[model samples]
Target: MNPPTPSKPSPPSSSSYSSPQTLLALINNILSIVLLSSLTIKSFTGRWQVIHSKLTSLGSSLSSLSSSPHWSENPLLQSLLPSLLSTLQRLSSLSDCCSISSFSGGKLLMQSDLDMASNSLSHSLHDLDLLLRSGVLHQSNAIVLSHPGPCSSKDELSFFIRDLFTRLQIGGIECKTKALESLLQLLSDDEKSASLVAKEGNVGYLIHLLDFNNYGQNSIREHATAALSVLASANDESRKCVFEEGGLGPLLRILETGSMVLKERASAAVEAITADPENAWAVSAYGGVAVLIEACRSGSLVTQTHAVGAIRNVANVEDIKNSLAEEGAVPVLIQVLGSGATSSAQEKAASCLAILASSGEYFRALIVQQRGLQRLMHSMQEVSNSDTLEPVLRAISSLSKLDPSARLLSSSTTFIIQLGEFVKHGNVVLQQISASLLASLSISDGNKRAIGGCMGSLVKLMESPKPVGLQESAAEALVSLLTVRSNRKELVRDEKSVMRLVQMLDPKNEAVYSKKFPVMVVAATVGGGSSHGCRKRLLAAGAHHHLQRLAEMKVAGAHKALQRLSGNRIINTILGRTWRE
Candidate 1:
């Protein structure tokens, strides 16, 4: 029996396998393979990550090197600017593409680094602008630096500008003076740098350098005043800094006592600082307006130019304007307008005169008494630049609004004719002022006759496709001129004049024409008498249709115009309506 049992067990081994143990071994082999593959993948991923980190580090280093001041100084590095900018732009795009998890909890840090790199590339471009200003970079290379950015990141560069100003203030005198001169030259048109310099309390130091006790050399004074001017005009904050740092007193002293160069710079500084009304009154309180007026009257042309600018800055203050006028600024400005001064200087003088004249009727009369109108008209004819013409026209316009001065404009046929010519000028402001002055001058019969010669031009304006504002102004001048019999006779001669006037009675034109039609009311009454031919011309030009339309709409001026046109007894009888008047 034992032999038989052992034979049975040995036979069972060949027919069947151990299913549980075999399956367990198969699972262990599969798991081992999976583990090996995972380890291989992790190793390659880590290596790739290391390479990526190194590339990012390299990029950061390149970005830093590009921002270095020496980067532009070296011709080799300067040549790489376009390439470096390309790389930075790519890095910026990549930074934006990254997910939050990609930075391993340093997403904010990564974004800040990218922003800094972008700004660094931007600041590097300004090196060429700086070099050009310093005469180190040639004009040909300016195109390379002419990218859209120009040190415009004010908040970022503010710290560096503050440091430069600090070094200029506390460092050695000659070195600081040279540094400041360079800075002023570089930043004269850069509002951001000037603002940063003023914000760091460096404006006080700049002003302090104006004193002879601190920086006695005229060169230093000249540089300091120039720097102050840049800072004072940078912004409202810089203007306040100039005011708070006693810049007004020192600038006034320079105006009163400094040399021509110093006075020129100081006058500009004062003008910039006193743009604020408080600062302007402060300068006036310190007797600066009188000195400014004297400067305008007798200084060198450069000095006079700066002085006139300063006067304009303060001319808004009533007391200052009166003081300037009393000190004979009116005559000086009038003379400058007529003289051979540069167009820029003439503009400033005319602007200042306009401000003074705008202050009161007394000022306007004073300017007229000084022959300002004659001088302005002379200058107007000589100059073709609208920059000069605009202010001169504005001054004439302002003066001509007053009854006393309107008479002055009416007395000069040449002036009236000059204004009528200006109505055809390409400048819209000149057109507006010319038209407005013509309307004002037409209040007098003599001026009406003078403006009547421009009847064709006025009719052309009424038919123009120009702005409704200009069309409205022309209509106003026409209505005023037509009140005079000779002016109406002139309009009747121009075939299109009546039609143009009719075109002006549009429902859309009510706002502009409403104020000018009291004269139209008088014209209708006057038309019934000897102005019958003028009335017939108006009717023959299809004015009856527009007048009827306007009357149905209840426009106040339309009814009178309708009644006047309907006063033709034959036409009235044809329409089967009797004359009511």
Candidate 2:
């Protein structure tokens, strides 16, 4: 028999050839061929040199990856293998063509092919490096072995977050979108995840996804912005990070052009980010004030609420207040107040208007001109909860600082009755604010008589030891109320009311409450042809000692009050002279 013929070596089948081990072997083979071609090819030696270097680096990375314990199990690597293999195969074919002695392709065509191959090789190398750096391979292996479910513990959740963040950095748009959805779900379900995202410095990646050009879909941007909103709402540090990472510009862009749902989500993010006073300028600097104002005018109620809230926070910065007014926020805010939006939205609009009104008379006049007072009064009647009522009352108080607003408010019997009720029964804050508003409204004589019905409540507030501002406010309001004859008569009729005012004039109480308003109140009560019995009641209330002390200290209205109390009695004249000395 002839020597047995050696069995012909068979070509590798498709499935086996595409296996991880086979792919690694094929990559090594192609890498060697490209290196040899780079050394020998003379026509485009420079291009080949660059291509060779890239392939060498890629080959080294592939070698290291193949040596990893779970290299075959890594989904990212498995998914990437086919494209990488195709690219390497094309690179090998181009190297072979360049090395051929008798090539038909033109010199320019050959040079172009070589340049394309070099770029392909460079891209492959970059992908491999990103894969190795991403830590996804090991994370996948660990995940598979442990089979983490639902992230029961912090460590487990951290592991899960790391995987999601890894995908966010390296995954394609679709992959990133999925990761963002999962991230938003996690954030919505668990408050701690936002803090973790901020701690891990992953906020920038989410912000990067906010760009529509990068993601190419509103869904992705919506999900990412919603996630950022939760993140910003959950943690102060995250809000700072969102602003510092330039999230405001993208958010404002969304407000400008995004769909209603997307704009709502972006507005929420802006609202959260601008909650910090330091971040307010970023919103204005990015021209967000106008965008927010427009959103307030035309966005959905939810969007308007968030936009108004963001404007409220942004207006906290003194410098941005003018910008907000210049951007025509006053009318839009007034519109929101009257548009039958949710009570929360109306409250935010009221608060934002309050801030703007406090900035200067221009914003105050602008708000009043737009019928803000009417809208605010309507809101006050519509909503009864303290939270909504507080801001509305504050806005009314701010606007009432303008005489026009005060005149408008003073005419509303409903407004005066509400103030009296709030002063008597509302929480301390409401009572203080209501008392202050009464003082503001009392600038009108009609208001003083209307507010006089609340004199009993005001007197009770002054007698309370806490919140000296409330005491001062009630005193000022009483001063205005006493300018009318009926209010002064009513005060002396209630002896305790006179006692409270007299008590407020004590020198020791000066540090607790200002003595000027009380002195002014006493002067108003006794001067301008008041009854002698009222003076007797004030003298009997031990007002002489407090007024003498205040007079020595030269508190405004004190000496005049003392003289008014002294009046033409020989004993009073001698006593007043001794006190004056």
Candidate 3:
């Protein structure tokens, strides 16, 4: 689609302000001229003479204002000047083509150049119309109509975007800028708009505008990059469009070379489009990781947030985790975690650490090397947001796998107590992570007593109907706590606790190994004759059948549990078996 070449009246106000009505009128005039030019170019008659005269007059007025002293001072007039000049240039081309056709007296315009200019003008005018009515402009207009999003409205929107893309292809900077703004507005959370824009081949337009290394205009580049991000963010198809159009290269360019604002915007887009693991790999291949790591190291909080988010997603690949740390992401992430970054930044930072930690002991040791555990634990105390806390807990859980780290964590009285409370009353995920941490920590002989003291909560967790993983974690912690004789004696004395342990052995639930281990641990404590009520509660809760079945399973823990139970005379009399048997 071609944009129209038509003269525009000079801005009425010397001041920077233009009322919404005047703005709308100016847009309408531009569209009207394009439409008229398209109709006039259909025939090579005197019609071109009338249109040329009107455009000539408009050109003179614009020239007069261009030399006026105050014209550059008014922002409104300043904006209008370029668009007016562009329109005049387009009109001048069309006028010359029309004169040739008229002199030859051809019934048809015969001049494809004139027809192409007129067609481009008509399309550009339509694009401007679409922008004006697109509801983005409505924010400035009081009596605005509602935005349309249904099927028909989307079709019309799709058509407008095609025209905008045409104008973009035709190389009018002013038209391209306006089209970028319109594209951004349409590409909201609306799926249809994104799909349409991608399907209509406008993704290339967005990528071209985002050519920050090539596009010298920072404002235009910023808008274009932002629009590209939005389009790519919508879904898989749109993201594929961006990647296929070679958007990743320019996005990385903006990240490395654009202004700070552009960097933040581009980083966010990188995060969105590279959401898929393969796409993330592509970004990493293109050396986006180093740029993002730099962003995390020195950029503003906003830039850090987006950069970290992108890193978090890209860190899905195991090799990338090492790459991130090798490039100095470990300390950067730890810094963001400790620096009191925004809740979102902290979440991403914590999550990135968690991903790295999940890769292996190397990353976990790295986190510990960076004082990551101390910082994470500290940040957990400062923030109450579940999202932030969840990742912190996950990283801590991963780190707890190392015996030295577990011992260190176990020694922190404050951290242990906080974790115990999380098991008791935190949300499901928090309960799960806390239980897992406590279970890991309980391996340290010194840590068992501290966890045993929180036996009441562990018992409650065993009885609660939570997700199977959480139940397993809680059960494991409970079993570890029972390894201490004092904890077993206290727990066995509580009939409810004994009954819960027996019920936990039912094996009907998932994670049967978790259930079996806890049962074996509890059974080991019971067989020692520490509590008189154990046999009665175990029989009362129908543990006999589950235990009998476990005994026949040939599992070592289950066998050991059965051997231990054999030593109880009351239990031996009931089952008619002994330890040696």
Candidate 4:
């Protein structure tokens, strides 16, 4: 009866049944929305924050007024109160407009910040341009990587850093020379990004900076010269870019008056440009080799290093190879290895010697005489774990064409054989060079016979889908195998033999097949004229058909094959019969 007392007012109407806890939670949520909206609007629209700040200021003023009887009595303060409170109330209402989503709110604030940053970066970049154009040092120095003022944009900040470097370089002469410290900072990095900037024109500025007239003294030139050394490590294209911009003349001039560091950079710039085949003749045109030769003789390891790389690059010109070799480069290069120099210097010399060996037979004989065989073999023997791959590739390259036959059938020949096997052991570069070395080694009768011992393996290598150079080299070695009369039958007997020979002799392939055409001509007999055993056997294998195709039409390199095929009347009859069909 007591529990039924008043029946709790029939448990209240459903609409009016909300619990005190629920009501309290709803009030708290409403208050939370109000407060969160105020915070959010203030964060996103920075201008909205000004309103918040003014509201806070108005509150402080009201608090100040309450602190003094005179403040309340003051007419000025009295009038300001209504206006201040009215403005704050308006803002509070507006704040309520922004509280729906936290995620959207965050995105909104981020967009605003980015806008501020972009605008700031733009203005800053413009100011930086003005400073650079004015050639005013203090102004330029003021616009640094640091923010001198609130920035325009966040997105372009990094681009701004790059543009500053670009402006410092491309600006008028006064502006560029004024940016020495800046240029040094940018070029100081040898990384690819920094090198991309350098390759664009940094190397040119460095060479220009070291120009004796521009620097005004050897010491200034010397400092610029040192900066150039950092630049040299950037890229081979940068050197070419510098050269194309007319940098070699100034660099060569610096080589005469600059310090060892300067001498090296000048030589390096020279080397970079001349590394391109198109520039080798230009380098020879500019007296580059003579200057590089002097630097190569320098006691400074850096000077000797770049000098060697430069001279080798310049030697790519058939025009300059003899001159480079004659200018004491060969003897000095050979000497640099034994000079107890740094490995880099020795490597540079070894590289130059390798390039020289590619040009003249004299160098080939001389290198073998100088025990280049020993040094080259030693370098090849040790494949270090260094991940710096280029040096290793370069070492392998220098040894790839050493012509071990010229070195006698000593360990180098074994090394070439081992190298051929090694070609199978690695990536594209090693395999291609290994094949190239094998082709060079397999050129003589004995060498061809030696290579013939591995013919089945070479044939296997050729069949595998490998790099073009390796395939080309294997084909070339097979061509070299044709120099021996006894080997021609075996070459003709292989199923894919004629096709490989045709591929080798194809001009469309741009391969070195002109020399092999004569061998194919010699090996191809049509049963009409030559009674040689190999010719008879080759004709027996339908080599006459391949030879008749070459001899009749001069399809690719058939001029010599034409000569041999012309003697065979039966081959002509066979060709006529085939063509008529």
Q: Compared with the true structure, what per-residue lDDT tens digits does model 4 show for residues 238-333?
A: 545565667667777666566666776676666665666776687667676777788777637766777777776676677688787677677777
Q: What is the lDDT of candidate 1?
A: 0.63
Please give, for residues 1-581, the per-residue lDDT of candidate 3 as tens digits: 54444564453442543443354345446535544554546445555555455454444443444344433332333344445435545654454455333355453554454555555444444443433333232222212122445555755565556555644554456656666666677776466677778887557667877764545677788888887877778788888888888898889878888888888888878888778777788766788888989988888878888888989998887667768878898998999987857789999999988988888888888989889989988987898998999999999888888888887888887788788778767888898888877776745555566656567667667656557676667777776666676777777677776666776677674434455655655565655545445555555556666776766865447766655555567765755543234
Predict model 2's lDDT versus the native: 0.75
**What TM-score does model 1 achieve against the real structure?**
0.63
Give per-candidate clash totals. 0, 0, 5, 10
Give the better candidate number (1 or 4) by lDDT. 1
Cα deviation at 507, candidate 3, in Å, is: 6.9
Shift of residue 427 alpha carbon in model 2, Å: 4.3
lDDT of 1 by residue, 349-401 (tens): 88887787677788888888887877876877788888888888888877776
Query: Predictions ranked by lDDT, top down?
Result: 2, 3, 1, 4
lDDT of 2 by residue, 1-581 (tens): 23332232232344667567777776676666656556666457677777767777886898778766666765555556666666666766666566655667788988887777677667667666766764555544543313235547876676667767766665677777777877877777777667777765377878887777875777777888888778778888777778787788988998889888889888998898888877778876787888988888888988988988998888878767878778788888888777778888878887887777777787778888888888888888888788878888888888887877777787787888788778878887789988887776645566567667678777777766677687788777777777888778878888777777787889886433567877877887887675576677787778888999999998888899898987767548655666577
Ranking the candidates on TM-score from highest down gives: 2, 3, 1, 4
> TM-scores of the models, in the given order?
0.63, 0.83, 0.68, 0.45
Clashes of 4: 10
Error of 3 at 492 (Å): 3.4
- Candidate 1 contains a number of clashing pairs equal to 0
Indicate which candidate wins on lDDT.
2
